[model samples]
Target: MYRFRPRVLVDVSNIDMSTSMLGYPISAPIMIAPTAMHKLAHPKGEIATAKAAAACNTIMIVSFMSTCTIEEVASSCNAVRFLQIYVYKRRDVTAQIVKRAEKAGFKAIVLTVDVPRLGRREADIKNKMISPQLKNFEGLVSTEVRPNEGSGVEAFASSAFDASLSWKDIEWLRSITKLPILVKGLLTREDALKAVEAGVDGIVVSNHGARQLDYSPATITVLEEVVHAVKGRIPVLLDGGVRRGTDVFKALALGAQAVLIGRPIVYGLAAKGEDGVKKVIDMLKNEFEITMALSGCPTIDDVTRNHVRTENERIKSML
Candidate 1:
């Protein structure tokens, strides 16, 4: 899905992956995507992930549905963290959580705009999976599964997520906090423009891990379109199917400020808890550094559009 033009004559030493996102300096452009129920992977859960992120000097976006509370995750370590929020059916609930995130020192509010309803995750359905007790809402709200629902998560999402959520809510969220609001789940140039018009601080081009819409285009395919639409108005981020350093390099070349990894971190946590998570992050960083070197990019800024080609471009050249 990607092609790179390497510069063998260029210096390969001193490659720097350090970059800043929303005013926070990170050691690398790689960040941990907000995935739910870390407890499902390890007993330490988000607490362990937070520690790993801090150790790596990267950002960690905490899920609203996290097994650990915002406060607990914040206090876990010194990592720069953002909170991913899903608007609940109750406006008050959304506001309360935003306030809590701000108070807990979360750097941004990653407002997920994709899921008005839960997606048909057949795997979860076959397993009859139930979500862990959403610890963020532990004392504040209680969500129970209705009888005969395929999974507890589905039932909870159906009852809790506000289907009527719209562009106007961006203004509502702005009125509540001064923290940067990054809108996630945009896959089109049209919606990307709308997000900028709505005054979001950033945009995350994602497909909810391809779990929401069955036939949606891959995030990488649409990333450049969304980036061109925004035209550097805000930081454009991508999160989906980024499994390698080359993937991250490809994303940056196409115009993403950074990329996020979800399932890999989960797998790492399950394998070795905090240490495992740290290892995963370290491996990605090392691989990306190697990629940058091979591609003749001594710095993150050097990884530009000229470094890579897309399938369409490749086909055009051959023709």
Candidate 2:
């Protein structure tokens, strides 16, 4: 569902994929999205992931449910990192986590907004998977449930996520931290406008990896809508189903300041630890650069809306 108009007369030898987010300079626009319990993927867990991100000179968003503590992950590498938080039913717990992240040098807080209740992941249910103890919250709080029937992740989310979460909490989060805040899990133009009005530093267009709600529009499909509603006032990022460099290019053209890769990083870590992660990043970087050159973009700035067309646009043209 991607269409690009190629230009043959452009320089292909030099292309820059570097871009800034939240005033931090990253080597490329690609970044690691927050995935919980990385220890399931590798022995070193988030520590290995952190080291890889540092080596690649990109950002990594550490999940609040990470297998490693914020301090442990921060100590593993000096990579620019963000912390993804699910506001717990307990406000104090949320505040403490934010404080720990800020103190540990996280540059931003990615507040996931879509999950008030854990979505039914049928695969996890069928596999009878149990989430590992969240290292970040270990000893600070207990999410232990009384022998749940489904995955521990579902149980934990059900117990911890504040079902009463509302827009006013955004201001409360802003008050508690000096770090920039990005509201993740928004997919609509109306919500995008609301996020901007709520004074978030950025917005992430996501559908909880389409695990939260079935039949939701793909992130790429709604990226332009959110971007348009934001009106250039704040950065809009996208996550979900980005496995190829062409996918990255498509998201960027539609107005994602950058895209986040979730499953690929996990797959890489599970396959070969830190080196695998670096390899995955390197592959994406190379392919994205090639995409840039082939599409007539010599730099990230050169990649604009005109560089690509959506399925709707193509169909309209035919009509």
Candidate 3:
């Protein structure tokens, strides 16, 4: 039997999604994840996204290979910004980026550990997608050699990736940044505990937005274990496949301190620059607030394992 829709407007009286990330207060815990090639999405690139973040009163994690430089985006908006660094073969090059981020007043350093090698994307490859040669790098690095000169994005990723990195380098990174350092790819409980023990500020429960390992479990599935491993030692954030406000509610219920939104925001930016991104953020926030109210969750703490059920029997039992 199908029930008729409620005639009255749904009341979102219980929406209180405010939270903090690295001591910075956000209107909500939702954040914009760092992705490469903002120029592909909008003419203003990171500047546009930064503006959206400012408008929504959210945070933005700017990628290392961004078309726009860190200073450019930082100056354009006062949105809480974190620098996402891709560890390279040359330690000095990595150090330069960290120093630059520090000078640019980035509040945190997000080290992406998932991509020891860049994963293959069929669309980018078939299109022969050479990312319109990073315009910002002109006076920076020698543009003589593009990241990929041959086959596709995958081949480019293969050559550009640095698999030789080790955890020991985290200490080296800590030495460079008084700003909080967050490891952005810890998935397993063991790695989560390691991050906690490393004395790092936080961990982002991620699978590189599922762009790295195609078959890896969705980020939401592994979030609880990571949160349990941290055991309140530090914050744990989720980033990947987050497309709606309900996704935020689900993530909060599963113990994610916050969630990071990616590609969708880019699409929004592509559609209409800053205003479009703001609308996307607004849509998610409104949906999350409504979901929390409908589910009888009035605050972040009101959301918990009790509000969630899983098809996985063992997992359901544990919850």
lDDT of each: 0.92, 0.90, 0.81
Name the better of 1 and 3 by TM-score: 1
Which numbered prediction scores highest in lDDT against the true structure? 1
**Candidates, ranked, lDDT:** 1, 2, 3
Pairwise TM-score winner, candidates 1 and 2: 1
TM-score of each: 0.97, 0.97, 0.89
Models, CA RMSD each? 1.2, 1.4, 4.2
Better of 2 and 3 by TM-score: 2
Reference-based TM-score, model 2: 0.97
N/CA/C clash count, model 2: 0
Quote the lDDT for 271 in model 1.
Answer: 99
Clash list (residue pairs), candidate 3:
none
List runs of model 2 lying over 4 Å from the truth: 146-148, 315-319
Best by TM-score: 1
